[model samples]
Target: MSEIGATPDPGEIKDKIKAGSDRANALKAYVDTVSIKHVHRQDIEMIDLVVKTYELLTEIMKLVESKVDEIGNAKK
Candidate 1:
């Protein structure tokens, strides 16, 4: 735990988010390559939802990294 008035580390935050993004990307790859012999309508819908969610997550990750960079710049 950080002490009172301690500033949080932006690098640590970015690293953690990047790690999660990497895992998400790996799962996306699996989703892209998995073979479904008999894909149902529901399966298709779910896959579509996942793809959209991933796109949004990608945007969010970019936003976070941008914010981190901004903070670092402000500190400099």
Candidate 2:
């Protein structure tokens, strides 16, 4: 939420990005640990799907960071 007509802050946006990345990483780790402990024949596909999804999210976050840097440089 922003005050009306308030300009967005890149620093704040970067902080948010960092936080999201951290959470994604934490979830990925937890999933990996849990899967290792409890993987089953019927659940393998679901686990793989979840792990791949997190991998995609991580890659997307990296791309977002790159784009932010690219845009900021262009603005300068």
Candidate 3:
């Protein structure tokens, strides 16, 4: 609360998003150039499968998050 009208301090939220984006970019870059020379073929295959599963999970999370946002906005 404030005496009159005042803007909120949104810098922390913005910084968090920027940090997340930076981390995502770094992970993408590393995944792009990742190799598995020391690991066996089956182990490498399992790693690839896990990566694909994670990608699918991320996609589904985006859809659910958007639906939640829609519901929240509808209430307003």
| Highest-scoring model, TM-score | 1
TM-score of 1: 0.85
Instruction: Give lDDT: candidate 2, residue 38.
Output: 67
Per-residue lDDT tens digits for candidate 2, residues 1-52, read 4467875566776888899888888877877777355668657777788789
lDDT of 3 at 28: 57
Clashes of 2: 0
On lDDT, the candidate that comes out on top is 1
Off by over 4 Å in 1: 1-6
**Quality of model 2 by C-alpha lDDT:** 0.77
- On the 0 to 100 scale, the lDDT of residue 1 in model 1 is 41
- Per-residue C-alpha lDDT of model 3 across residues 3-44, encoded as one tens digit per residue: 356542344434444565556556556655766667788867
Off by over 4 Å in 2: 1-7, 35-38
* TM-score of every candidate relative to the true structure: 0.85, 0.73, 0.54
Using lDDT as the measure, name the better of candidate 2 and candidate 3.
Answer: 2
RMSD of each: 2.0, 2.5, 7.1
- What's the distance in Å from true for residue 34, model 3? 6.9
